[model samples]
Target: MKRGIMLLVVATILWGGNYICGRYLAPALPSNLLNTVRWAISSLLLFGLLSMNHKRLPLFSQWKKFALLGFVGIFAFSTLTYLGLRSISAAQAGMISAGIPIAILLFTPLILKERVKAKAWTGAFLSIIGVVILIRGEHAANGHSSIVGEIEIVLSCIAWGIYTVLGKRFGKTMDPLTMTAGAAVYGTLFSALSCIGTVRLNMIHMTPLAWLSVLYVSTFASVGAYLAWNTGVKIVGAGRAAPYINLLPVWTVIFGILLLRETVSILSVGGGAVTILGAVLASL
Candidate 1:
């Protein structure tokens, strides 16, 4: 259980770092193209691993579930996230994304018919309040912050919540490796289609550093972190596993201060602390 918790922390930091990578790499590689290449690499690597193990992939009966997972988990989540980053800072995106646990908690009773305790309700409410403060900070920091961008972030969180709920339904029946492989394959295709009009093949003129960012994100952040997260959640149970993701906002704040030299206001720290505390409580 401790190992799973540690792995979850590692996954959250890596995944949060992807936001920094996306912010830096997005201008060089368009959002759709970045997403396309990330998923393409994931698909290739996972497929190669499957071949090496002589494991037969998912059958036709499971294709539909994989397709839904790909659409919601990868396509919708990645596309909207990249688009949101175009307008928001990586730190702000991470902080706002702290709302995902709240989304999952709210969706629990409605979608999963799970019982929620009074303490959990209080935690969810506090988390929502923290999110609102973070959103206000975004506006105060950037005069041009748009409501549309905030909505996109919220929708992306919702997409993930839907994926989590759906995963509970299908994940028991499907192998995690096969499910991830299938999602990557379908997501790569969907991303490729989405990029046709937005990014050109000839537009890949990124610097070596940018290329490094892309490679790091594609390999470790997208593939390795995801596999670790799934395994960790299984070992520790979802409720215990979910709160570790709140670490991403904290990591993002650290990255922003060290890498971008951005100011970390008391509001940011206090809000993040309250938000993470609320998330931990809500997940109980």
Candidate 2:
């Protein structure tokens, strides 16, 4: 259990670093093209690993599930996030992320047909209120802040929640690795098709540093972090493993300060704390 907790802590930090990478890349690179490269590289690497192991993916009959998973988990989440990160501070982004469990809880009843208790509902309410506070705080302090960016981040949260709830249903028949690969394959295709125009017209003459950022996000954030998370979940069980993701906002704050030189407002910090507390409550 200790080892599992350690693994999950590492996973959450790596996952939180995703925003850092997106923050670095969003200004210089086209979001769709970067999204394409990350998903494509991750999908290819996973497929290659599957090939080496002589493991086959699901048949074509499962295309619907994979497609939906790919759209929500990869295309929508990454695209909307990068678009928002272009405007919002990484600290603010972390605050938004802290509310994801609440977003998941809000959708669970409709998607899973499972009702949560009143405590969870209250937790979700607090999380939404926390989000509002965070947004208002950031908007007042940051000149570049926009309601548009905050809205996009919240939508990204909703997309991820949809993917999570749907994964519970569509992922029952497959192992974690297999399910991820399945979603990744369709995600790669979707990103490729969506970014084709951007790739052809605007994807030229990027600096080596930008390329490095793309590679880092593709391999470390997408592939390594996901594998670590799945392994942690296997060791600890998904229930015990999940709350570790709340660590993301904390790690994001740290990295945002050191790596990105972002300053966190007092209200942002308070809202983030409230948001994390709400998520923990809802998840319980």
User: What lDDT, from 0 to 1, does candidate 2 have?
Assistant: 0.79
**Clashing residue pairs in candidate 2, if any?**
none
Model 1, residue pairs in steric clash: none
Clashes of 2: 0
TM-score, prediction 1: 0.92
| Cα displacement (Å) at residue 46, model 2 | 0.3
User: What is the C-alpha local distance difference test score of candidate 1?
Assistant: 0.78
lDDT tens readout by residue for model 2, 1-284: 88878877887788788899888887677777788878889998888878887889873778888889888988888889888898888778878988778766777788768868989888888888888888877877786788898899889988877776676655456665776788787887887788755556544446777788788888888777766765666667544554677898899889899999999888878888888888888778
Q: Where does model 1 exceed 4 Å of error?
A: 201-205
Residue 278, candidate 2: how far off, in angstroms?
A: 1.0
Clashes of each: 0, 0
Candidate 1: tens digits of C-alpha lDDT, residues 126-149: 988887776776667667876677
